[model samples]
Target chain A: MMEKVAQMIAVTGAQAVAHAMRQIEPDVVAAYPITPQTPIVEYFAKFVADGVVKTEMIPVESEHSAMSAVVGAAAAGARAMTATSANGLALMHEIVYIAASTRLPVVMPVVNRALSGPINIHCDHSDTMAERDSGWIQFYVEDAQEAYDLTILSVRLAEHEHVRLPVMVNQDGFIISHGVEPVSFLPDDVVKKFVGELKPIYPLLDTEHPVTYGPLDLYDYYFEHKRQQIEAMKNVEKVFPEVAQEFFKISGRKYSFVEPYKLDDAEHVMVALGSTNGTVKYTVDKMREEGCKVGLLKIWMFRPFPKDEIQRYLTGRKSVVVLDRSASFGAEAPLYEAVKSSLYESASRPLLSSFIYGLGGRGIAIEDVEEAFEKSISGELVTDYEYYLGLRE
Target chain B: MAEQKGWKDIPIGGTIVEAGSAREYKTGDWRVLRPVYDRSKCIDCMMCWFYCPDLAIIQEDAVMKGIDYYYCKGCGICASVCPKSAIEMKPETDFAEEG
Candidate 1:
């Protein structure tokens, strides 16, 4: 007799994300449903009603209140989860930063979508980019498989004592969130074992010993508290890989916070994050076949800014191109600039390039990256903070 | 103002510290100005005490006081009912230093 396993289940990426949440068996989930992010919360709420998953699902009145509730719940030592999209995440901005710095280890699944200017809702990086400074460790997933895998690893990573920051797992709205695909879900026992038993944190609403978590820090204590957040982030660069190794050992699907594809002796490489890296990697493999030296560096973890991994990957490269789906307004895209600074200390140099592509849900193709490589080599390289690629010329 | 008599002296809650800390407290976040008074206001004919929503205004030994801060948002109902000009709306920001 063989045990039935969900080796490959055909489900929407939203379902995969939601199922993963149940597998983590969070203690509390408070979320207000918005378009492109509604189904996930709905599915989880149903999970609660059916007793399929033992969790408290609080349907909130508004996104802002949902965030506030999660912060308070998490501070009270609950394993909390929430899902939201563009404007929803925008509504959660203030608390999002607090959630991270408070080190409550709240995990959120962000369905990446475009911010409304003229009003459009599809796949884009605008939402998560708006939260780039929110101190949450962001993992951009291109497909349902990665979504399921990333969601599980998030709990493992965030709960690390040294890396107690909230994490955001980003999946492109409508693309990955709505797109149905066969995903591989780890068994409940397997996931439970991997996630381990959640330990109750002290002073977490323990009236026996009242303790403050998110206090209004005076100017004198504010910087020190902020340093504490940064110091925890610094530990993640060391702890993430170790945790990931344990994940891979059990699940057999491995991911580094930073993945460099075909960079092994390449003269130039394109560095980008999120689901878009799939296209870049395919293009890099094709270019390699033609004896071209172009490669791809895919960023799996955007928050901790894997400087050491980046420095190691870009060491011997001649040129590097970074593509961002969101614009930074006054400066270059956050990831592009972070990579440049990380490489600055490296003696093995590469002429770094920057491109702000796919803003406002615009489509990007393999040709866009191929074109970027051409312009970079011909010295038509972008001299500005960022260049708009695949946008109306 | 005589229609509104004794305002404070309302046993908002049996609290010693917060009740006496300030005789009057005002919170108008509810889109209406409300005033609460200290316990020294007398002539409690139960006018202001009867006009309250939760009946939060009460008379203690012939003196009227409002609800304590714990349960009292300082809606000023007690002050509104006081015909004696004993109740005045005090802003919550007055105690911002305490926060």
Candidate 2:
């Protein structure tokens, strides 16, 4: 297939994702507007109103209903999608699990935000982190360009024959969602050919060849059904790269489960996901200028947690600092725990410490990252307890 | 009993590929009370046929025949809706060996 000249446009992360959705032209979009994520569906809604895309847009009452509607549409063999933020994701919690277990390939872009307690609308990983075990293929993007690219890539990944599972493409709430950046697009026709049409195995709408979905599965068969889902997730780990390779051919960007930056022969490394990876990269570059042996590992795909690849990159490093945006209450932070587990089988592993930072959108400046890096290199970072970054004493 | 399928043999996502496969599961075994029809007292109102939730009422050319005990779960909707009391709900124990 011949590649088309990429269209360069300056847009917020939410609008970039919306542009991707418009190009894909999903059959149905059932969404309820929430902060940060609202602009995505809002822009798509405008596309429907202006006759740019012939999508059946359903303005739902709640996030719960929004996901439920998407599930229904997907079951009927339609390519369906939705978007939400922190509290909205929490509201859709139940159906979110259903969408995956039922094996419907629903693509949803989640604008990462802090979960509510005192109720602040800001950037954090609390929302998606809470859903880490919900059986969805999750991708965390660093900028608007990646967000746009991953949103398009997620559709193909979710609908792959061997991996018919839902996908969540995450971007930082207001930091990336509302922040304007230059994003390149792969012309509408190229994207449409790349995504292709969803060919559902047994759609509920195929009346002539009817199939029963969401049946009351009992003890006799429930375990077996869950086993099938496990196998499907395993397929995602394999199929993701193939789909991404095809995407790379059409668009010049490549994606993978973990993206390592300047880790060759580095002694100290910082591990993180989402937009914080961008900051960490800047910090690594600044530290390297002063001859500091520092690098960064950015986990793009969190679920089906890329253990072997992560272990490979961090194996010989002297020390590794994991920055988690969400706290796991009494336990080690989510990403920190995963990194710890991944390294358990390695013959030689880095001395790892967990740092909880930027909860409720507390900004982590370059100085803050430099401070963490300096402490890790000096072996002063605590391994037993998590250090809090940007927390007031 | 049909051979119980292993996880690999079953369809992905627990989807039942065979449409209307519920017909294969004989639910009449669940009936604790059976509805007995008395043809002589029948008013032919077809109320019993219309009210049978299980579609257990056998009918041909709009004419009521005996109930199909194969699927009747004995909800007794047929007996309750009989305008002339043509159908009676009888305890399963009363007809000891009958299916």
Q: Compared with the true structure, what per-residue lDDT tens digits does model 2 show for residues A226-303?
A: 998889889987999999999999998999999999999689999999999999999999999999999999999999
- In angstroms, the error of model 1 at A129 is 2.0
Residue B71, model 2, lDDT: 93
Best by DockQ: 2
Predicted model 2 interface RMSD: 0.8
Model 2: per-residue lDDT, tens digit, B1-99?
Answer: 235789989888878989677877677878999899999998677898888898999988788888998899999989988889889999999988653
What's the true lDDT of residue A277 in model 2?
Answer: 91
- Chain A TM-scores, candidates in order: 0.94, 0.98
Lowest summed lDDT window (length 10), candidate 1 chain B: B10-19
